[model samples]
Target: MTYLFNQPSAFAAELIEGFVAANADKVRQVRGGVVRSTRSKAGTVAIVVGGGSGHYPAFAGLVGQGLAHGAAMGNLFASPSAQQIYNVAVAANNGGGVLLGFGNYAGDVLHFGQACERLRADGIPCELLPVTDDISSASVSEIEKRRGVAGDLAVFKVASAAAEAGHNLAEVFRLAQHANQRTRSFGVAFSGCTLPGATHPLFEVEKGHMALGMGIHGEPGIKDTLVPRADVLAEIFVDNLLSELPAGVAAAKGQRVAAILNGLGSVKYEELFVVYRRVAQLLASAGVTVVEPEVGEFVTSFNMAGASLTLMWLDDTLETLWHAPANAPAYRKGSVIVAEALSPAEREEPVQETLPEASAVSQQSAQRVLLLLEAMAQQIQSSAEELGRIDAVAGDGDHGIGMERGVLGAVAKAREVAARGAGAGTLLCRAADAWADQAGGTSGALWGVALTAIGTALGDQQEPDASRVATGVRHAREGIMHFGKAQPGDKTMVDVLVPFSDHLSQAVAQGASLSDAWQQAATVAHDAAQATAQLLPKMGRARPLAEKSLGTPDAGAISLALIVNTVGSLLHDKTPV
Candidate 1:
């Protein structure tokens, strides 16, 4: 369990703060995460790798010379927001473009992909390298669906080495792709890890038993079996990875591989060495050569009693890149010539947005929007624990906390903009940006999209009518679907959002009042959310544990329903048109 934390919600932020302070010479703090304090060579592709916060050394620790240019850290087990990724990329960008690398999880894909598009739109060349190395997550036929695990280290190292060698963006991306293709990892957990301030761990394994193929984000393993001897466990890891050799590697024999025996969190180095001893014997017996094999924690889940093994089959180019010099906070390969530190002037600052002019009617509407945001914040704060419980059934169990952080940030931003006499549209847009920035996850990005869509539909110059509001809601639905790629039956928030938007639009078109229409739609949303309990998840982290989520409604769907119902009640009370 996490013993040192002031507040659970503030843990991720505080940890980043302390990490930057400790490694000030190596890395500097940025808006989202950390960037190399030293300047990079001109025209080198910036390698930005990231994921959730608990995996120390993986994200922030890897930001230094000859490694990642920066890392966009997220909430406990959540993906960083698009705004966060964009900010880091902008800070890290040199003359060359950016290469964003992360685990191939649903949230990471959604957030990082959005950031890539935004960077491209801004005329920055950007590419994505999602590491898919965990063989347990998906079958070989569906290799693209596999989740990234400790194997992220191999991909990050190779890509960053290529970038440091002054390779252009395209070449860096190609090398990273090659690294990802050659990597494979498998893990087992004796026990689960607890989040800060949580009374219980995310999941548990029975005593004397170990969970096979567990994830770094506190996800339970796919299967359970009695704990085996260290040599036997080593055999299991070697056997699984050898069973599926990457394309181009016709056989494990005569193949040179970079082997990493990673301790998830609490597993000691002594224990890992014992396992690696046998691991070495197995590889040697199989005629596979081990090169620079790492035997310690590289990517960890906060204090999880688990370990994983990764084997990256190395060709000539990969082997040379794998042996390249690297200097980071936690990872150091060899001697590197220290570069000059970035000057204070080179560091970027937050740009304050200028408020647009607003009419009196629109300004008054902003006040009503502020009230709605406040109510949503309160509702989320009250229901966060329950929402997290539901999500923990199959997901990472951070939904409630994520929503609380998002809604609170939105309310705060709305209040700030409304006090400046901003219009409803401007206020909502500002709030949307804040929600995405503060929350930093899939739901955060989706909610930000939804709010921005509504705000765009209702321009700042005019007061919104019932039809205009319905149109805005419909646009929100469309935007979420476009960005999230989840259909109604995917067991996501779309299940509730689509029905609510359809019903509200239909009612408004039939000349119903805004309040009445919203009330009716809220009922439909509530029913839709409840129906999610019977549907299996086809997206997100829950997909791997679909059966476990059979009796629980999606946390995203539930939160959307609750927020819309809260808004419906406010509308019914005649708070505003």
Candidate 2:
């Protein structure tokens, strides 16, 4: 699909242009995208840097009061050259020297190395600091080659403090290097991303899968798998990150870190915390001290569906810099915590109201069906985080967690239903009821209605068939609309589900197996979800945000299409291995 979002060519220029225009009082652009402050003190070690674009506040966005002295801007996913780096360093070097810090990439090293040598020739003291924090993207043997992700901020902050304290360029450079050596990070992506002028995505996984350790420039990652829950993925990302650090090498060591949970883009704050809850616990268990954990978009790849965890072993100096007074457009060190309060007894962060246990079931056929359903439920349960990332595009972005909770609830209900010798329809309906009751959101209500309608249509007597399955979905759509009051044009999941069920019913009535009919249904749903981007959404929370959502398919509709597609795929293929 064509991206409605800003093209890097157009986007980068606009962003840098606006930043310079508004921050005029705080900074002055030197030759190349390198900007300098007119007020920077003479003989004060200067912090000069740049990287690929889209990670504002890292190389450019933070070039203001009490922060960096100069920033060399680059194009999207493209680093600035030696010329650009030289321009910034020459301007920023006022005898106290200049410390250059940037993400580690081959191009950056080549260019920054050239710039450093050039500055040295000019009698300007210069040292280079490259960030290597995303352990997810590299092997220990190849850590030096791994591209820096969100660790830019932590490492840079250390250098900035040294510079502000009037340390010679050498000392400042050493501190920045120290931060880079100790910091580590990891990321997970629900979907791939694209550059401004690109057509196809830079990387792609199955609709329901995630790419673990996906890098900044839409780089492919080490692992790809279905991820349905934010918390589960959070646990995985956190564990991987913790395992890489020296502090996590042993418990009771109590290593301290200032952590960052960064939203690449489009992933909202409301949804990000679900991941953070698990991450915090993982770090605590590893005996890593989290001095202050930040949760927001500090580094982004233009609405890419992912989050990265950055951990820095906070030495006393780094801790002071982290807590140092600072202000920038997207970040402020004094940023207030938006987290809700928790009493001692009220244990869970979100108070994860655990679902009831599955009931025992007897009938062999019923049990087999449940076994298959359980697989689908397990798949959903395992995919919560990725779902949230995809859903953030259009709907409320809670579909991942909501869908996961609903599936688990359905699993529990399925066991109880099967135990009572309930018909296929009856079991499905009971599961639907539990899903709706436990999962509090739109997806829950829609799936719940679908299951309930299917059960009623069956009336406790008939075996499920292609035609009846389609009929049940149709009835479910009707029920969903009645309660949700959402129309097909409203850019909701109904947009995809209604047409999907209709095609299923028509195809089945025309003679098709359950598998074939479902496959067709999923296909139509996929197309429909994509088509919702073209329609005007007139209802839901999306209506207000609809303008920004143009050209982006509804995440809820995408989820429906994905879940249905997976179910059909499961029915057609060998059972889950």
Candidate 3:
């Protein structure tokens, strides 16, 4: 359990500050994360890796020469915001393009994908290669759906090595993808990890029993059984991983592999070495050669009592990359030639966005937006716990907290900007930035994009007519779909958004009043959210535990319905045109 913390929310930031101070020779503090203090060769493809902060060496620890150029560190067990990812990548980028790599998780996918889009729009070349190495999350046929775990090391190392070797962006991306395809990992936990300031773990294991197929996020394991002896546990780990070999590998015999016996957090090195003892014997018996075996904490959950074994099937290229010299703060390989330290530069002031002038009529509508934001915030606060419970059925149970954080931030920013006489578009754009920054998750990014799209449609210079409002809704729906990659039947907020936008557009085109159109759209969204209970989730973190969510509405969809209905109440009471 994590016992050391001043404020739970501030833990990640504080930790990063300390880490940078302790490793000033190797890394420098950036706005979003840490970047290499040592200079890189000009025009080298920068490899940026990141994820939630709880996993130590998996992310920030790997930032240095011949490893990751930078890392976008997020709050405990939560993915970083898109702005954070973009900032880190910007700081790390030399003249060459950037290759972003991380675990295959929902929040990471959304944020990294958004950063890639923004980077490309700004003419900075970027690509993403999400590592999918945990075999238990999905079947072999559905490997892309699997979650990444300890095997992150294998993929990141290969990609960083390729980049350091002067490989182009395309070649580095290909090597990262190939490494991910050839890696497989399996794990078990004696107990779950406790997040900072939390009294209990995310999930519990029965006493005297062990949970199998555990992840690095403190998520409960897929299966549970009696705790085995050290040798027996090693046997279980090896068997599960060997059950599914990488494609083109006919058998374990005569195959060379890189083996990592990793402690989750609380598991000590002595315990891991005991397990590895049996692991080595079994591998030798199977005629599989283990090369450069690593036995210690590499990737870890916060005080989680568990361990995992990763096997990366190696070819000649992989072997060369795997053995390449690295000089990170935490992990070091063969000796590396140090480059000159980065030149000291004065910090630049952040550029402020200029707000366009607004018409008096649009300014009045902006006040109405402030009211809407207040109502939405109140509704989210009241429903947060229920939303979390629903999400916990098949996902990490943070949706309620995340939504409440985002809505409250949006309301606060809207209130501040409205007080400054900002127009609807300006207020919403500021609020969008605040929401995404505070929430820091998949939902946060999608919500921020949706709100920004709506704000764009409602220009500051004109009055917001019914047609324009409908257009804004349609724009928001499209933005969410494009950024989140979620369709209506995926049982996400998109299910509610699609119907709501369609109904609003149809009603407004049929000459309905703004209030009337909104009422009809809210009804459609509410119904769509309820219908999600009957549909299986086909995306996001819930996809792995799809069956468990059979009778529960998606937390995101339900929250969308709640906010829309709350807004409907305010619209009903307003003066009708």
Candidate 4:
């Protein structure tokens, strides 16, 4: 169980602060995450790697001389926001372009892809490389869908080495993809990890059983079986990896591979050595030679009692890059020249945003929007645990907490802006920023996009009428579908959002008032959310275990329905004809 935290919500930030304080020799705190305390050569490709923050020694811990230039760390067990990714990438970018790398998770994909687009729009070249190396997450035919596990280390190492060797952005990205393709990881957990301040673990296992292929986020594994002896466990790991050698590798015999026997949090080094001993014997018996066999924690899942084995099958270039000298806070390879640490940079002053002019009617409408947001925050807070339970059935169980945090943040910002007589558009824009910044996950990004898109459609200068509001909702739906690449049947929030938007637009066209139209649309959304229980998830993390989510609605879909319904109730009392 994890302890030692002030507020559960503030844990990731505090951990980053302490990490920077302890490793000042190697890392410095940046807006989104950490960058190298030591300056880098000009025109060198920057390798920016990150994921959720629970995996220490992975993101920030790997930011130094020859590894990642910076890491955009996210909230615990959640992906970073696009703003965070963009900020870190901007801070780390040199004359050469930036290469973004992280695990092949849905939230990471959405945020990083958005950041890449933003960077490119601003004339900074950016590329993304998602590590899909865990074989257990998906089958051989859909290998690209696998979740990245400990194999992330191998991919990040090779890409960073390529960058250090003066490779261009394209070459760095290519090498990173090569490393990811050549790597495979398999893991087993005796138990699940407990988040800080949480009373129970995310999942559980019987005393004499083990979970096979469990994710690092405490997501239940694909299979469960009786616990085996250390040697037998080693056999399981080796046989699975050996059965599916990388496509280019002819056979395991006489092949060189970089092996990482990683302990996931609670497992000890001594135990890892025991497991690796058998692993080595098995590999050697197959005429395979292991190079630079690492036996320790690389990527971890809080205090989950589990271990994983990674095999990075090496070719000439990969082997050379794998052995390159590197230095970071937690990981170090061959001796690296000591680069003098620079003093921390002064914080930049915040630029004041000019408030857009607004009409009196829109300003009045903004007050109603604020009240709706407050109600949303209250309802989300009340139902968070239930939403989390629903999400845990098929995905990482953080939806409820994430929604509560985001809605509360949005409500707070909306209240403050409304007090200043801001218009509906301005209030919603500020609230959207707050929600995305505080939430820092897939839900955050999608909600941020939806709100921002609506704000854009409804100019502050005009009164928010039923026609305008319906238009804004349609715009929001389009933006979400384009950004998230999820359709109505994908079992995402889009499932409800599409129906709600269509119903609202149709009702408004038929001369319905805003309040009445919203109430009807809310009914459509509610039904759509409920209908999701019969569909299988085809997107995001839940896609791997679609069956497990059979009878439960998607957390995002359900939350959207709840918010719409809550807002509908408020509309009757507040919206003017």
Candidate 5:
């Protein structure tokens, strides 16, 4: 979730600082996000550009030779305020005034309109050129409501160059709008994003499903569908975009054009390229030129899982800028038609699997515990919803559901080694690693703690029995409560923990044997779990669900109770617990 280059609120300013530090000779900041060249020719219409944050190379990156005259920067996914836009227009003014080129968003319109009004007050002429190239998949009744997307690049490049060449503001706006008219784009999303330090994701599509036509800021898409493979997905995306193009604009076999394959943050290039292959073929079949397209992340939307395709019908004038030599951190190009490529970017190293750090459990007994945990994981995998509903009474409705699925995933790896049956400690160690990686949240870590504690309880018991079972359950609860910071009265698993351990301990102390004590503990845990509703959440996720939990026990405590009862039931005469 962390933004790579700079902090959030400070990003716009730092990016400008870096831009000036690197290209002081080519561009200069004018006391705002706007940057201009000192030698901008007189009478040549100035191109004022801008947009929200995160799209590093787009609004700012394009502010170089043969591109924008200057750029007005804004916050993340937010439009530049009116004053910022006015500043850019004022600095870029050469008396002949400027052409303001930007994306078509409601916020952008509101801010830019005020900036234009302010400029008119100063007697400066200004024109607004908006890019609306996203061929919205919305139905006819909904088309007017769609937002602008990636096609802004080529269209702005064309618009900016027109101004740089001494074309009047009117003509520059004309060309920019023309580009918007000729260009079309569409996108789809799979998962969602997490702003830095966020504990949960901002949005969610569905398990194994994608929402086509989703916007950049976690907004809902036109529709959700089971994600198809790259080839089939490409056909759907490209075909939709093509249908919206003017009937014959790109229908000629040799009509030279360029295609931009954009990733919506965190999508891997290989997957993007796979989808592009379909786009390339689709364009070829329809008689459009793809022109050795660039395939990489351009404009991104945080960590959302999706991508968009923007195809611009190009002429020699637009094609020249597309081929122009340029280089910026996020976007790059070389005029050279042929050359040996530079060394490739480094790949991320795979994580090595090794035993985790834990001392309570030894390598032997841990393995047997691993077998038990894995078996339990499989049993709960399909019960996420059922458990979730049970927890709904006294805990977060998701506790049962999340735990069921989370443990199953963690067990997948743990079971593999356990199937061969190693000692308890070794298996527990492996299980701990898998649980943390796959389970992902507080519950996952707690499950791992339980596994390690079981290893500790099994200690030197060569042929473990009910006594070992009771000891392990007690130790496991201790670990969960210790690190989790939730107690019995706090409406957590401790509710059942206190009763379960006490029953088993007393039974053993009063001359009861392992079988009888284990059975008593199971019965105690179930009723105690149901009793959690008597307490209010004083800690953990259940606290939020506490008031709602009134009249019911915490789901986690209940779940802990269920798990212990199950484990205890397996302990019997002449059998290892």
Candidate 6:
């Protein structure tokens, strides 16, 4: 259904280019995303919000005077890489500090959290504000696990307003948290969305039936029922939200709230207004007051035929900030005093590092590493579609594309460094960085950790032998476990990685050659990956729809197995070690 695209991989980048060109007066393009064209006060808290690229108006469109200072844009339905988030935060930072706000999805959490640590290490004060507003994703008792949806707007607005009001980083973060606590959203979809160049939708709803509690990223709904009239749908929305008022709000009666009736991409404004009509009547009947209710798209999935209702229970402070003036490209509340635009020279430029000198033996090893990366890239490209199919059973179906992008980036970077006569360790490290930067998801971050750990274990000065290679692989496993926080039974990539690492280490310790040990370990990885089909996902986006993934191997685990197997073949055929 996404008819307009040059190439699937290039879609996100191209759209961002066009977006900046059209909104140049309001925002300017940065390395990873967009920042406000106008400069803010010297010591104000900078609000940097971001997520995957499909949700327009949510991210780049909200970068302006009274909204986000900048947004780290990622590939379609994938979180931006940690490097991307860091770049945006660095560019957006005023002298005070930076507040990173994003939906509480797994990928966003991993990438943003990493960026927060990096920012602090670079002497910049940074805090995280993950929005959890979707009531359908988790139980009230498990509110922290909820997925952020349309209600992100309310939290972003209030937090940005606090920053604009000259609040310090602590105050801004506190207000953001308060706003997140007060906001609740519920969404439904008439049909699923298709990514650009895809022949089919990620998931489909039965004809004449509508999905309830569907996610914005084309995730299938938890339940399905026959389509109902607009009034009935509105009633469903009101009843669900009112039944679970936030902890502070005793009841819906006499409560003043900001309501947002959001149309997810394909839903028209007219349809939303019709739904909002009944929503308003129901609220009034329940003695609840609606304050400046907005009835249109604020956040969206790319052309998903759905809508969501968000209620932000407003306190006095929240209400004042809600009513404050804002001027973004897509969202404008009231007139704002335009600030001076930033000149080209004021923007930050990316720093390039020079390649370090390497010994002849290490340079030869780097060539072998490049060959291994190229083979892995080819394997991932060939299997991407199948991997995506498996992921769509329960999670967002972008795993294949994400892996493909990541491996291709890694291969390209490896080739560049190997040509420059870099050592094996330095080449692998650079390739890992490129993979993470290009893919920008949970898998991307985890793979980056794995490769970096391996690179660190094998120093650039010498040719790594079988024992050293085994140690590097074991370290890779440890790093992945630490970074991803998933154990073997969690049905993630760790399921495969752990077994492979252990087997390889044991075999190498018993004096097996690197090629033989790797071949044996690849078999272990394959079995572990297949065994994941019987396990339930305990982490990431697949956790909520665990039942649906019952008979399918995890996409991440499968991809890791495929890569390791490819590497094993390469090692057996060519690499001396």
Q: Would you estimate the TM-scores of all the predictions?
A: 0.96, 0.56, 0.94, 0.94, 0.54, 0.95
List the lowest-lDDT window of 10 residues for candidate 4.
344-353
Q: List the residue pairs that clash in candidate 4.
A: none
Model 5 bad stretches (over 4 Å) = 3-12, 22-25, 137-145, 247-255, 315-577
Clashing residue pair totals per candidate (backbone < 3 A): 0, 10, 0, 0, 14, 0
Task: Give lDDT tens digits, candidate 3, residues 347-402.
Answer: 23246546678878777889988898888899999999999999999998999999
By lDDT, the best candidate is 1
RMSD of each: 1.8, 25.0, 2.4, 2.3, 20.2, 2.1
Q: Give the per-residue lDDT of model 5 (tens digit) for 26-72.
A: 56666436454435567777778887766656677677555676787
67-133: candidate 1 lDDT, tens digit per residue: 9999999888778888789889988998799999999887788789888998999999999999999
Q: Is candidate 3 or candidate 6 better by TM-score?
A: 6
By lDDT, rank the candidates, best first: 1, 6, 4, 3, 2, 5
- Which 10 successive residues of model 6 have the least lDDT summed? 344-353
In the range 29-129, model 4's lDDT, one tens digit per residue, is 77779888787888999999998888888788889998999999988877887878888898888779999999988778878888898899999999999
Candidate 4 residue runs with Cα over 4 Å from true position: 343-367, 393-396, 416-423
Off by over 4 Å in 3: 218-222, 346-367, 415-422, 544-547, 573-577
Best-to-worst ranking by TM-score = 1, 6, 4, 3, 2, 5
Choose 2 or 4, whichever is better by lDDT.
4
- Which window of 10 residues has the lowest lDDT sum in candidate 5? 339-348
